[model samples]
Target: MKENIIALHQKNIAKGAEHLFLDKGFNLTSISDISETSGYSRRTIYKYFESKEEILYYLIIEGLDHLVQSIGDAIDSEQNFLKRYEAICACMLFYYENYAISAQSVNRFQSNAPLNMTTSVERIFALGVKINEYLSIWIEQGKEEGILKESLDVMPTVYILSTNLNALFELVTTKGTYLFASLHMTKEQFLSYGYTMNLNSLLKEPTK
Candidate 1:
């Protein structure tokens, strides 16, 4: 029961951090803000987190864990390598489109690398490691199945995919309308165009 209570307190603090960080922007938010927003005492917050950066790291990990779960489920449901890859893209877009604010926050963090707190930088690197592992596993599977070309360098391909996806999300969350509105493209439509190009370039043709 004591452990259960501690878990609940930790979760409450994390929830508060998420709300305040998103609402006030992480840079502008303070512990007082979280205390007022979450109704958790400063002592309680400190009990669960070493600092504000720790709280933000918790939120980032929470978001990444959720995305990994969704992507895992989507990829598992598909038998075809290419289809699994497509499901990966779909799950990614679903999360971004639904959580555009978080996406925007991530974009800001990426572009403002100098402003990154130690905890946030470590957390992002941790997430990058997870992404690289996932990309490596899936791309290797595709190679063995002959759906990805045999000559593909897995790391380079992974880097290319990750880099472009970040750029795509940044654009869609910011300056999307200005960059794409002239072409009468909605964000989803624009994403589809990007996704299609990636697939065409990455996937090997089925044997006749």
Candidate 2:
């Protein structure tokens, strides 16, 4: 079927782009590179994506969706709040360590060429809204259970928590570098450091 072919092309393009990104990063990989690596004609590549940036955007979008889903599953599998938070930390740490390149690309994907395209911009915004909704639901559950502070508003709290967690992870893993390095720490090391900070921040009272 035509749809199946398109799907196959899209998957190939994604894999090709990811390979190039890991090797050369977003700024270096071109449409031609994607086409050649994917073994699709440039015209065929364009049939699936208007531009290379569109491909990158979709890649990042789908990657984050998978990340969010994993986190949701991890939290759902746990009973206690602390254990759930631990599971959440574990999930994030997994991505931070294993998929660091893709994660970093997401921040860049927002500012890149595809994001400026109206249709792609709308899709990115829609995905953000969905991601925020997931974060809000997670926080709502935490709040309802009295683990998260009672006065927290979902949207702002989710934004704050997500941003802070990213920064905290960056601080630990980045060492002294300005850019967060995906290579510096093992997953266990990063998780231990980041989770300690996370659990400490969540506490209403500090233990001596």
Candidate 3:
């Protein structure tokens, strides 16, 4: 069918563009680069995607989909709040380790790119909200179970966890080598310690 063929072309274009974006980064990769890499004309590329940012937007969506699924699976696999929280942290590290380009693409889009307010952008924000909601649910469950501090405000706890986790991953991704050299700790060690500290901060201290 014609629609199927269009989908195929779009897939091909996105595949090629993903490679270029990973290799050269989103900001440096151009329409011409995408065209040449995809073996599609610039006009054809335009027919599928309105702009480079739109293409990046779709890639971010794909990445976030994988992340959300991983977190969901992690949560579903364990009933213990602390176990589930650790699993979620592991899932986040897995995402950054495996999907480095998509991870970087997300950072770049959020920090530097101007908001275009496309439907794709909306989807990206929705996925972000979904992620936050996941964290909020986990935090609330912990509080109910007496695993997390009862006084911890759910939204503020979510905000701190999300912001600090992102910062930790971004730091490890961008300056991992420097950190290793300066701090004498591997990226894995750093992240493990960071996650442990974050977890401890929320946990209710056992009654003596």
TM-scores, one per candidate = 0.78, 0.76, 0.84
Residues 87-150, candidate 1: write the lDDT tens digits.
Answer: 8887677667655444555554546457645766677666757767787888898889887889
By descending TM-score, how would the candidates be arranged?
3, 1, 2
Judging by lDDT, tell me the better candidate of 2 and 3: 3
List ranges where model 2 is wrong by over 4 Å.
Answer: 98-101, 108-119, 171-190, 205-208
Q: Kindly indicate the candidate among 1 and 2 with the higher TM-score.
A: 1
lDDT by candidate, in order shown: 0.74, 0.71, 0.82
Go through the candidates in order and give the clash count of each.
Answer: 0, 0, 0
lDDT, model 2, position 128: 61
Worst 10 residues of 1 by lDDT: 99-108
RMSD of each: 4.0, 4.3, 3.0
CA displacement after TM-score superposition, residue 125 of candidate 3 (Å)? 1.2
User: Which candidate achieves the best TM-score against the true structure?
Assistant: 3
Per lDDT, the best of the predicted structures is 3
- Compare candidates 1 and 3 on lDDT and give the better one: 3
